[model samples]
Target: MYDEIFETVVQITHHDYAGCIDKKGWDHPAYFREQIATRQLNDQSFEALMQDYLRDYQELHMGFRRLEQESQRDVGFTVRRYEDSLYVTSSQQEKRIQVGDRIVALDGETIEQAAKRHARELKASHHEREDWSGVLLDTSEVEVIASSGGGRTLALQAFTKLPHTPSYKIESVEDTLILTMTDFWNHDAITELIRHNEGRFQNAKKLIIDVRTNKGGSDLAYSELLPYLFKGSHVDLRDFGDKAYTLCTERNVDLRVELMDQVLQTIEDEKTRHQIDVMVRELKKNRGNGFVELDLSEIEDNMSFDTKQGPEEVVVLSDVFCGSSGDSFVETVKHSDKVTVIGRPTLGMNDYANVAMMTMEEKFQFWYPTSKSSAVDEGNGMGGVGIQPDVYIPWTPEHLDKDVDLERSMEVLENFTHKGSNI
Candidate 1:
């Protein structure tokens, strides 16, 4: 099973035109074979080994999965690398651990040691992370400056914030509207949400669009949002850039066809269905013909949804969690004269997309990108550093309870003169 997994990934890595192309970090077939051969390998151990093998890539999109085990044991929150130090990013309320608190050590492992070992990958299984039981956490002691905990100790309960449930709402805060969406896959749901609440939006002068927890979904989901964001005097071209290149292989084509078949059957919208149909047709036409360029934008959906004229100013809130189509959303809205993204950088997985999956005898699966965007060579790649915010707000503990980003957005809209005021 291990050998098979390695070979499958190796084949895709060599053929797929993405970041791992020509990278020989994980090429020691015999070395890995010997290492795993000597170890008492289990599911978790194999996963760790594979993780280390692919650690060099550290890509948010490139990873492996299996019959979804609860791998992450939540000790109230997850820690992430901010500069050279590790800070608490997300925490459950009961834990009383503030977001942005600096942790000096976990399970006796110092921050420097853990950082060296894990690099950028901080998973539940790591030695520093909490187990099914728990681990000792030593927080930094400072003069209450931002994230210093002043040396505290507590046994945080094991919890799971995994398997995120989608949340969506449009709240009317006097004149300003707060649109918080955690999803983008349900087609024109956002469009419908806006249209249904048209009167509310029309009256509002400043709009705060929050996607801090929104991981992302289909691009079509935000189709209705384009017009509201457009600040240009002319039309919103919404150029998707040059054509994306997909490695034309039999397996790649077959997987795409299988995936698109579901799209054809599930999506009721005729135009969307047609566009997907066209993609699949193109896949079949160019299978095993080396790398081929796919221009899906050529076949237009021609959505005639009425662009809302209200919301003179728009502030988009994003986080590091926002990625894939989420990154696409941030990029797409940049063309809008009224849109100003304010938050942390995104997850940075937009360079290679249209993820396809391959299952190995239902035991495990390898999901990877099928195509590489022209943006890679065009100096617009989003593999490492994702879309940057117009107004950057560093993550702090005050944001644990309060929506600091939103407050900042409000501040920007009320006092700070923005370029969009004239638009």
Candidate 2:
């Protein structure tokens, strides 16, 4: 049993480490087997072994961190990076924490002080700080300075302060429709957002999508929005090595393609069905080779605008906090003339996607990015290098008093009107 477990772990790691693994680091399957051949298989020992393996692939969602003894409580809010500080934007109602609160300290140490102290353990990016804030919230109480110039303490609890509503918000800003999506985890929410805002989206001359703090979730959620945005035929590509697998079930190697099986079965039009059939067949033709082309125009789903008429001018707000599926969304749309990305560079975490979850025993589980993606830029593979914005606007602390990024976006749109995008 021990050898079997060790072999399985090695097999999964070798095939699913997102990027290539260094043999000198821990790539030797035989060496790993020998190292743990004598240890008794328990939660503690297995977790310790897993930790050593995780240190090498520190990319976002590259590995799962499951502490057998640590409490899983969280503060009711999530935060994002602005300048060099972390600020709360959404929270659960049970906690006193509110949106626009800046996290100053955790466990009694100032954030800057903590970052410096833990520098060796953390990555050299603002996204690391944002993630570390969430990690801290999992275990300790935090100190925050609210936008109203007051201070308070927030502690972790079973419930979070973030509202359990739709992940997106649609509102009018002059002639533009401002759509702020906090995440893409809820497919139902995405559908509701599109259905609810179909009329409003058509009336607006332009649209602004704010995904600054979105860390990502399901691709199915954001892909539902692509049909409305892209005008012409486009192809998106993904790779899953020679083979792909999800820990959840024994489906085909590619889960994204597998999701289409249900949709294909429901289509009644033979012509539409044939077009989709070709796309799906092409997507799955060479599953083992790792690269597959997806035709955007072929996919027929009900999650789009009836007119198929998108905004004349589009703006996307991004930051280093936009990671995972958020990275995928930005990378996919960056090339279109209909959209312009603004603000800081997004968090690069989508190069390796299609996370396969695996549970070890009953206490530990592992989530690995089994599929490699070339959607944003072919061969570039957005691992550490994320999507860059067309218009660069750095966030300043004073912007907490004034919405600088939004104002800049509005100005850019107005300039496009008068200057015809020359400015």
Instruction: Give the C-alpha lDDT of model 1.
Output: 0.66
Best candidate, TM-score-wise?
1
The runs of at least 3 residues in candidate 1 whose Cα sits more than 4 Å from the true structure, single-residue gaps closed, are 20-30, 69-76, 80-90, 93-102, 120-161, 232-242, 263-266, 302-308, 416-423
Tell me which residue pairs clash in candidate 1: 231-337
TM-score per model over all chains: 0.82, 0.68
Regions of candidate 2 where Cα sits further than 4 Å from its true position: 1-7, 21-52, 65-71, 75-113, 116-121, 127-130, 134-166, 185-199, 215-308, 374-379
Q: What's the lDDT for residue 123 in model 1?
A: 30
**lDDT, each prediction:** 0.66, 0.62
Q: State the TM-score for model 2.
A: 0.68
The stretch of ten residues in a row with the least summed lDDT in candidate 2 is 239-248
lDDT of 2 at 246: 25
Candidate 1 lDDT by residue in tens digits, 1-423: 777787777777666635556354644556667877788887767766775555555555666655555654445566554444456666654356767776665545665575555444543222322111112222222111135536664444555436777767888776678888887876645666866887877777888888766777677677666666654433535354445688768888898789778666656666566777888888999989866786555575443333556788888998777888888888777656678899887766777777777777576677777777788778878766777888888875556568899888888787535553532
